[model samples]
Each structure stands twice: as C-alpha cells, then as structure tokens.
Target: MELIVLDTAEAIASRAADAIEALLASKPNAILGTATGSSPLPLYDELTRRYEAGRISFAQVEGFMLDEYVGLPEGHPERYATFMERNLRSRVDMRPGSLHGPDALSEDLQAACDAYEAAMAAAGYCDLQILGIGADGHIGFNEPGGPLDSTTHIDELTEQTRRDNARFFDGDIDAVPTRCITQGLGTIMKARKLVLIATGENKAEAVAHLVEGEIDPRWPATVMQNHPDALVLVDPAAASLLRQRH
Candidate 1:
C-alpha cells in the first residue's frame, strides 16, 4: 500500500491520470474498474481532458462500475449507471455499451449479482480499479460487518452512507435508495492494482483508518492495506488526521 498526499483534488486527479495513461500505453485492451461519487469526479474530468487531447483512447478498454443503487429508475439522475454515463462514457471515445454495471433493477437481485460476477470472471477481472473511501470507510457498498471475502451481492446501505449520498439527491435523504449491488471486497481485491482518491476534511478519519489501521471489518476500506499494489491519494484536509507523515 502506498499513500500520497497531494495539494488538492486536481493534483490527485492529475497523478491518477498519469497512472491510467501509463497502463493504457502498455495494455490498450485492459479491463478497468471504475467508482462513482464526488471523490472520483475530478479524476473523471482529467480523463476526459486527456481523451479530448488525444493522449488516451478508451475504444478498446472495458469498464466495470463498482456499484449501483437499487430501486432507481433507469434514467434517475443519481443512479450510478446514469452518473457514469453523464460523467465519463459520453465524454470519451468509449462505445455506448462497453461500460457495464450490476443490474440493480432486477426482480431477482441475487441472480443479477451472480451474473455480474460471472461476467467479470469471464473477462478475467480488472487490470486496474479506481475507488473512493466512504466517510465510514466502506468501499463500493461493502458496509461495516460484511464478509471480507464476499462476491458480488446486495447490501443494505448504512445510514451514514445514505446521508453522505444525500447531496447527490438534492439534499433529500429520503430520496436516496436504501440498498445497492456492489462488487465485494474479495471481488475488488482481484484487480491487479487499486487506486483510491479521497479529499475533504470529512474523509480525514476514514483515510487515517485506511492508511494505518488493521484490516478490520468495521473500517472496511482498511482491507486495502493487504492489497499488493494499492495507491491512496488524498489532499491535505483528508490526510490531516494521520499521525505519521510518511
């Protein structure tokens, strides 16, 4: 695990872009894992810039979304699928159907999760995964007390997660979905590399746990500490609670 403190969110995104650019340079057809939420917005913006500048092309890249909220309509503004399309796929050279996400709308959600997992397995999982640490340290939707070795599955959202995601729903917490289908911790660990972006003072404590704490289920993101190749990028505010600078 490697932790890097940048001056700002933009700087962190730029650095993350460097990594993606290098990976695509080596493997044009790489399977890529993507995350949603405000933490990764700047990184998506940077990627869009690089695409527009002809520095990177996603024509052959395969993208997998980390999670999706249940019960949202297909075009719901806050749906992870809609969010990724509006923020990324449409901004680059990627094909319309190349980016895949779990079927949150399926009546048989458990079956949907199984199919999603099988699809990822067929593709041999991701070469690189982009992530965001929740305020409560959840990754994807793997909430506290969940199994570390879980696969793709449905999960109940913690109240903290729902409150945190309320901003995307126009500050209406009740508008947020209570359940989600997320690639589990075990599934995420299958990626060859993991890159996590975090910022803001609100994320400080979570970042501290992810960087320095043990691999406990309570601080779910702490599982990254065991990944052979994981990079944590944060701004000063997010890194503020760390007792050891190095």
Candidate 2:
C-alpha cells in the first residue's frame, strides 16, 4: 500500500483523474471499477471535464459499480445506479454494453449478486478500481466481520453506516436501505490496481485504522494493505492521524 497525501480534496481528485486518464490512454477499452459517494465526486467531475474537452472518452471503456443498495426502487434517488447515472454516466459517452451494475430489485437477490460477479468476470476483471472508505472502515459496504474472500452478496448496513448515509435521504435514517450488494474484498483485490480516495477530517480515524492498523475484517479497508498495487489518495485533513517520518 502507498500513501499519497495531497494538499486538499481537489488535488487528490486531480491526481485520481490523471491516473484514470493514463489508464484509458493506454487501453481505450479499460474496465474501470467505480465507487459512489462524496469521496469520488471530484474525480467524476474531473473526468467529465476531460471528456468534454476530448482529452478522454468512454466510447470503448467499460464501467462496473462497486456496490448497490438492495430493496430500493429502480429509480430510487438514493440507489447507487441512480447516483452513477446522474453524476457520472450522464456526463460521458460510452457504449451501451460498457456500463453494468447489480440490480436492486431482482426477483432473486442472490441471483443478482451472482450475475453481477459473472458480468465482472466476463469483462476481464477491472483494470483499476476506485474506492471510498466508510466512516466505520468498511469498503464497498462490506461491513465488519464480512468474509475477505466473499464475492458479491447482500450486506446489512450497520447503524453507524445508516447514520452516516442518512444525509443523502434527507436525514431519515429509516429511509436508508437495510441491505446492500457489494463486491467482496477478494473480488476487489483482483483488480490490476486499486485507488482509494478520501477527504475531510471525518475520515481521519478510518484512514489511520486502515493504513496503520492490523489487517482484519473489523476494518475492511485494511485488507488493501496486502494488495500488490493499491494506493490511498488522501488530503491533509484525512491523513491527520498518520505519524509522519518527518
């Protein structure tokens, strides 16, 4: 694992954009694993700018969302698909077959998870995966005690997670879906590269626990420490807990 501390969130986002741009440049059909939420918003914005400027295009690129809220309506404003479509997909031009995600309302929820895993496997696995750290140190909704080798599957959001995500649903904790389908740590580890973006002081403890603490399911992100190619892009506020050599 490599730690990169940027001056601000904007800088971290720009660096992430640069990484994606380089990957796309090397392989137009690169499979990109995407994450939703505030951590990656700036990276998406930067990608939009590049797409508009013709510096980069998604025509041949493939996208796979990292997780989704199960039991939510197809068009639920809080669904990960809706979040991706509105925030990122709407801004780019991509082949119809390039974007894929787990269905929130599939008749067979387990089948949905299996299908998503199959789709990812068919896509040649992700060339690079973007990630966000939950306040409780979870990644892609793989809460504490989740199996490191598990594949895509249903997960029950913890109370801390529900409270953290309540802001998106107008502060209604009850509105937060109790279940989610997330890519497993083992699946994420398969990516050729992994980039985790985090900002703000709110994430400091989680970041520290993940980077400096033991590798345990208690803090899902800590598993990244064992990945061959994983990067943690953080701002000063988010890296405050680190004990710097200098």
Candidate 3:
C-alpha cells in the first residue's frame, strides 16, 4: 500500500487522476471500477476536465459501480445509478450504457447478485478500482463484522451509514434505502490495482485504520492493507489521525 498525503483534496484528485490517465494510456479499453459519494466528486471532475482537453478518452472503457441502493425506483435522484450517470458517465467520453451497477431492484435479489458476480467475472474483474472510505471504515457497503471474502450480495445498511448518507436524501434518513447490493471485499481485491480517495476530518480515523492498523474485519477498509497494489490519497485533514507518516 502507498500512502500519499496531499495538501488539498484537489491535489489528491490530481494524483488519483494521474493513475487513471496512466492506465488509459496503456490500456484504452481498461475496465474501471467506480465509486460514488462526495469524496470522489473532485476526482470525477478532474477526469471530466482531462476528457474535454483530449488528454483522455473513455470511449471503449467499461465501468462498474461499487454498490447500489435497493428499493429505489430507477431514475431516483439519489440512486447510485443516477449519481454515476450524472456525475461521470454523462461528463466523460465514455459510451452511453457503459457504466453499470448491481441490479438492486430485482425482486429476486439473490439472483441479481449472482448475475452481477457473473458479469464481473466475465469481464475479468477491473484493472483499477476507485474507492472512498466511509467514516465507519466500510468499503463498498461491506460494513464491519462482514466476512472479508464476501461476493456480490445484499447487505443491510448500518445505521451509521444511513445517517451519514441522509444528507443526500435531503436530510431524511427515511428516504434512504435500508439495503444495498455491494461488490464484496473479495470482488474488490480481484482488481489489478486500487485507488482510494478520502478527505475531511470525519474520515481521519478510518484512514488511520486503513493505513496503519492491523488487518481486521472491524475496520473493513483495513482489508486494503492486504492488496498487493493499492494507493491511498488524502488531504491533511483526512490524514490527521495517522500515527506514522510513512
């Protein structure tokens, strides 16, 4: 794992964008794992800027979202699908219909999960996956106490997660879905490389656990410590809790 503490969130986004640019330079048709939420917004903006400048093209790239909320009707403003489409797919050169998230609305959710896992398996997993750490240390909705090797499946959203995400639902926790279909830790680990962006003091403790604490399920993001190639980018506020610099 490589830890890079930048002076600002924009700096962190640039560094993270550099990784994507390098990957696209070498593999234009690379499979990219995408993440949603405010932490990654700047990175998405940077990518869009590069695309407009002709420095990058996502024409043939395929994108898979990390997770999606269940029970939300399609086109809901807060749905992960809508979020990714509005924030990234529509902003880049990526072909329409190229970005995908789990089928959380399926009546048979278990089957939906199986199909999602099968699809990712067929694509050979992602070449690079973008991530954001939850304040409670969850990754892709894999909350604490979940198995380290879980696959695509339904998971009950933790209360902390719901409360944190309520802001997206206009501060109505009831508007947030209680369940989500997330790519498991094992699914994420299959990526050839991982890039995680975190900012804000709220993320400080989680970043500390991810970078320095022992690999334990209690700090779900700590699983990144086991990835052979993972990059962690953060601003000073997010890195504030790190006990060691290196």
Residue-by-residue lDDT tens digits, candidate 1, 8-71: 8899999999999999999999999999999889999999999999999999999999999999
- The number of residue pairs in model 2 that clash at the backbone is 0
Clashing pairs in 3: none
Query: What are the models' TM-scores?
Result: 0.99, 0.97, 0.99
**Of the candidates numbered 1 and 2, which has the greater lDDT value?**
1
Mind giving the per-residue lDDT tens digits that candidate 3 earns over 1-246? 999999988899999999999999999999999999999999999999999999999999999999999999999999999999999999988899899889988999999999999999999999999999999999999999899999998999999999999999999999989999999999999999999999999999999999989999988999898899999998889999888877
User: How big is the positional error of residue 237 in model 2, measured in Å on the Cα after superposition?
Assistant: 1.2
Q: Measured by TM-score, how close is model 3 to the native structure?
A: 0.99
| Model 1: lDDT of residue 217 | 98
User: lDDT at 213 for candidate 3?
Assistant: 92
| RMSD to truth, every model | 0.6, 1.2, 0.6
Tell me the tens digit of each residue's lDDT in model 2 across 1-246.
Answer: 889998987889889999899999999989999999889999999999999999998998889999999878888887898888888887899766467888768889899999999999988889999999998899999999888888899899999999999999999999998998899888898899999998989899999988889988888999998899998999888889887711
Q: How close is candidate 1 to the true structure, as a TM-score?
A: 0.99
lDDT of all the models against the reference?
A: 0.95, 0.90, 0.94
Total colliding residue pairs, candidate 3: 0
Assess candidate 2 and give its lDDT. 0.90
